[model samples]
Target: MTTLQWTPRTDAPRALVVRDGHARLGPAQATEMFLPFLEQAGFEVQVAESSEIYADRAVMERTDLIVQCVATSAISDAALRGLLDAVEHGTGLAGWHRGIADAYRNSSDYLQLIGGQFVSRPAAPDEERGTDESDRSRCYTVDLTDEGRTHEIMAGLEDFTLRTEPYWVLTDDLNDVLATTTYAARPDDPWHRPITSPAVWTRRWGDGRVFVATPGHSLVVLRDAHVRAIIQRGMLWASRPAAAA
Candidate 1:
């Protein structure tokens, strides 16, 4: 039998921001955009140097939410276990783009926790290339599902278009998909049919919640009002709720 120790919840929730990973938007930019918003939302925000802090049980115990922007990085077994344990105990986890979807490539545990993995973002065939490579950054719409329109994080939001890297992710049915984007097959592409991927989703992990929005490739994308609102709200939605007084 395993014994669960009690940890007190604070009035102002704590948010741990992990920005360690290779990305076009460095840690500074990502932190700059997110830190202030978190503070304004009444969170005691801390930007972690690396994923190592995930193993800090003392810190994890008080943590109400984790906003991770790590991409293509490695997480130690201890750290991964700590993170999973924290969430399993009620701490929230949320991220956008490669932050959550493209991270911890080697950890099946992390993948299972998040419920999705980045496969590839198929680009237009070489023959379709333009001098400016407009085909590469094609515009596409993120269509909202019925649930999305009513979901707390995306309530009253309408379908929106963005011209950025359209992600093609491999996701599980466990996710409550809120929005999606479809990739059209080009003549030069091998696939004969369209490929649709989840643009935004949420998952229930034990007592915690996980939120992912696969659109923030650049600060420009993150600046989109819809994207910004979703990410901000998602962080809050995923956080551990305060205990009754």
Candidate 2:
């Protein structure tokens, strides 16, 4: 998982890459993809398999940004406080898929920091499972908001379709919805019609910025040239000293 071909920036931005929690959710896989991308994109990244990074004041202080790929995990009260203090003071926070939105279901403070929470998958009806739209594979389209089409993170990226999980999330208006996906009620689904959710977005936590992309459940979807480019830029921007847009 090490590829040093990509050079770091002359003044490299330091990033703490933290990943731990649900395996099927792919924190490891995300680290595998993101670490190399960060190195090449000119970031000096520190990898952490545990949530301890949240409590390391020295590390949190010097770190320019945090890329959290963790899912459904808990942090020590102190660690959560420290992480929050750091972010409130301006350390950027960014993540993708289940990493940011779906992690720490019980941490309301954490949920507020990210401005959203993963509720249910809005399962399509299934007689066997007795629920509809429960993580079934389906086609979803990501359409950019007018702002998103020209935003720095999404610049030059066109609307695209991805076949993946349409995560049913509960988010407030605080999030500047960047891109969204629409899902029609298949005959098997519970709803008789369609529904849409934010596919990509950015939010603010105190002085810090939060960037998230909600549609990366599998490699085929995440590796798409457009998707990769957007994430690369988002990660870079989350940290300071990013490459020019």
Candidate 3:
């Protein structure tokens, strides 16, 4: 692992492109609500309505932090290559909920890169079934692991609750699990066992860093003071140090 020096400001303006075509939430919601959050965090943000531009190598190269708020969708081979290349060369990548975990579902290479995927949930079936954003449930407790407490990204954080989706992820190669949520078995479900699912994690592929959190199913989750702080630190932590790059 390489140590990244903390800087007052990032080198280039970061871009947060919300892919409207594939997102469960429409473009207006993402652009109006989500983009502002990044801009407020001090990044020069741009919201791309479509993913077509991602295919251009030059466009991908110029980006520093690429935040994909899109759900599962097909991407051109060129686009996939471009995004992967940017990360390999030291660009940071961060996303929460299905924006990333479920994005590019068909690409095994993509899944492997991100470290996991959304398969199914047993504890909160009703919340999963509801399409209305308001119908989503909240207020779940997350346990931060030892690894999580030591990391700079998790600095000054403790077990916190967020009004967001409780994620049941299918993962194997998570480098470090910063936080987790416990699930109790329901009568309808076959598995009656309790399991701890990773709520936040970080992985490295080549030179790039990938940080993921399964909590951001709604704007409320994103707006939580603790959640916002974690994401802000995560973006900075995930980016390659300027010297390393």
Candidate 4:
């Protein structure tokens, strides 16, 4: 990743977002958009393409938030363990879509740390890289959980429709699910079941707060007014003191 150009507010918190492995997701658009988004929220941001960013213990210690938007299998065990240690000691961990949960598929330490894993999804169509709106992703709805209605990060957010990948996520009992989506049976994925999976969630890894929004496969979805708000709030929410969580 090249150096991101953004002015920093001295009073703002620091965030490190790692962008690595992504299948069909647009890393370029995501990278381009997220810089201004986090900076505008008062985050002194560092963007790295290497999963090895996890190993920079000094950076991890200074960072208030760590957002990994990388591939599922590219991160190393040492790096994962380093991140896990940092978060346990106080760093916040977060990711949009596969960047958080889907990362480190073979490492139980990574999965255990994040509290969820990306099991599978509706088949993503092949594409030339583009924004979410221009791409026209498969449509789905995002509905808040009962608890989400009053949740500070979700305050004023409501159920909304989006044209994006409706993930069929697998989660553990530890996840505090905030929002979800129901996938209707389709000819392409016809089953007797109408699956409702977590679209947004927050969980604790020791004292470290963790947030995941599994809806972003593009800048289009990520750039949505609601979704962008959720991502910003989610990162800020996680960065707060654990006692407040």
Candidate 5:
């Protein structure tokens, strides 16, 4: 992948948004939805087609925030190192759904940076073989954790229901879990009990911050007021402080 070129700026904080679409969602839709918001927040936003832009060490060093939406893509070693180094040096990283959780399957460092991995979305027991994959989403509730009630990003948000993919993620204690969703095991499920996974989380990686949310599977889900607020706030909360930037 070729590195994207851009002139570095000092007037305002910079945000690097990497967008790549797969299946139902398109980069255009995601960009259209988030670009204006970033700009309005006084950020100098640079849109990239791939994570390869991470290879530009000069730009990455000045970037205050990165909002990536690419899924299931492999990032080159130099690019991956550049990204991790940028974040470790105080750049903020934020993403939603597969964009963060399911991305970079080959890179353990990337996984450690984000602090979560997409595992599986077990189908409902009533779901039949050969069922239309698009309509398989079921309604589930996202309940805030105790810390989430006071956390700046999740404060005052009530438990909300979303009819979308219920992600079962693999995460460690390093994450500061803000919200969660429970998967009730039906009789047919291999696991005999309920399982809960982090629906939203934040982590401190060196001098930087990382934010992840698991509910954004489509444009509709992303448009939900609660979901949108969480993501937007998460981005801001993860961004390098204006003074620091």
Candidate 6:
């Protein structure tokens, strides 16, 4: 597989705004990794530290792409409105794991825009103490579908393995499934029998595009060769198209 070479758009540099709304996972680390990645990929990235993204009017209007690292929570009314309006008019939004899925847990409008949520992880028993430093992390293999192999976002990538939390999401509105992981229930398990969980998918919400991957729980997972490629492509694909909506 040839390494992708990005060609810059001359009309105006593609602008990407990243919001670290949840503050669960360290916000500093999220910005450090993603900002450089977007810059190298030919985008002008602006990092926002506020929980309320819509509060910044200038950033909201100029943003061509929004990468939200926020978990489920109450966002300001203006923030929600700005984000929804931006996407409706054509601004791409993308994120991996709980950042997008767990965001705005109580808002139906937010869910409608992103297309899904983190319902439950049936395979793993609910940890009473919640995810912490000592939670057992394991290695898992990801299988890319034929469609994944053909899509630009996943093109040239081979099946790869990574060590992280294998999130089992429940969603029915996904449009294009690029990759999935196989999960087998333990003999003592009481929830699900066995299931294949989607690790990556693309969905359309209004005029904007939503790309999500359930694999980016740790920095190690994001830095993996195949994982990095998938994310890089997904970010580019999720950005609002360079045409009038």
Please identify model 1 stretches exceeding 4 Å from their true place.
1-4, 125-129, 132-135
Per-residue lDDT tens digits for candidate 2, residues 1-245, read 21112233346578898999988877887668878877887667899998877887777767778999888888878778877877776678888888888887777898988887767675533432334534576665789999898889998888887766678777899998888877667686667877878888888777678888887788777788878887878876666444411
Give the TM-score comparing model 5 with the true structure, all chains together.
0.92
Q: How would the candidate models be sorted by lDDT, starting from the highest?
A: 5, 1, 2, 4, 3, 6
Give me the runs in candidate 2 sitting further than 4 Å from their true place: 1-11, 123-135, 186-193, 241-245
TM-score of each: 0.93, 0.85, 0.82, 0.82, 0.92, 0.83
Tens digit per residue, CA lDDT, model 6, 15-84: 5555565666654675477777788866777766665765566666667788877766678777777777
Worst 10-residue lDDT window, candidate 5: 1-10
**lDDT per model vs. reference:** 0.87, 0.77, 0.72, 0.76, 0.87, 0.71
Model 6 clashes, total count: 1
Cα shift from native, residue 63, model 1 (Å):
0.2
> Can you list the residue pairs that collide in candidate 3?
none
Residue 201 local lDDT, model 3:
92
Q: Give the range of the ten consecutive residues with the poorest summed lDDT in model 3.
A: 1-10
Model 2 TM-score, 2 decimals? 0.85
lDDT: worst 10-residue window of model 1: 1-10
Better of 3 and 5 by TM-score: 5
Instruction: Please list all clashing residue pairs in model 6, or write none if there are none.
Output: 72-102
Tell me the tens digit of each residue's lDDT in model 4 across 4-34: 1222234557888887776576665676676
TM-score-better candidate, 2 vs 3: 2
> Candidate 4 or 6, higher lDDT?
4
* lDDT of candidate model 2 versus the reference: 0.77
**Could you tell me which 10 consecutive residues in candidate 6 have the lowest summed lDDT?**
1-10
Residue-level lDDT tens digits of model 5 in 30-67: 65698889999999999888788988877797799999
* Alpha carbon deviation, residue 55, candidate 4 (Å): 1.2
Question: Which pairs, if any, clash in model 4?
Answer: 21-70, 21-71
**Shift of residue 12 alpha carbon in model 3, Å:** 3.2
Per-residue lDDT of model 1, residues 121-159, tens digit only = 779546545688544566789999988989999987999
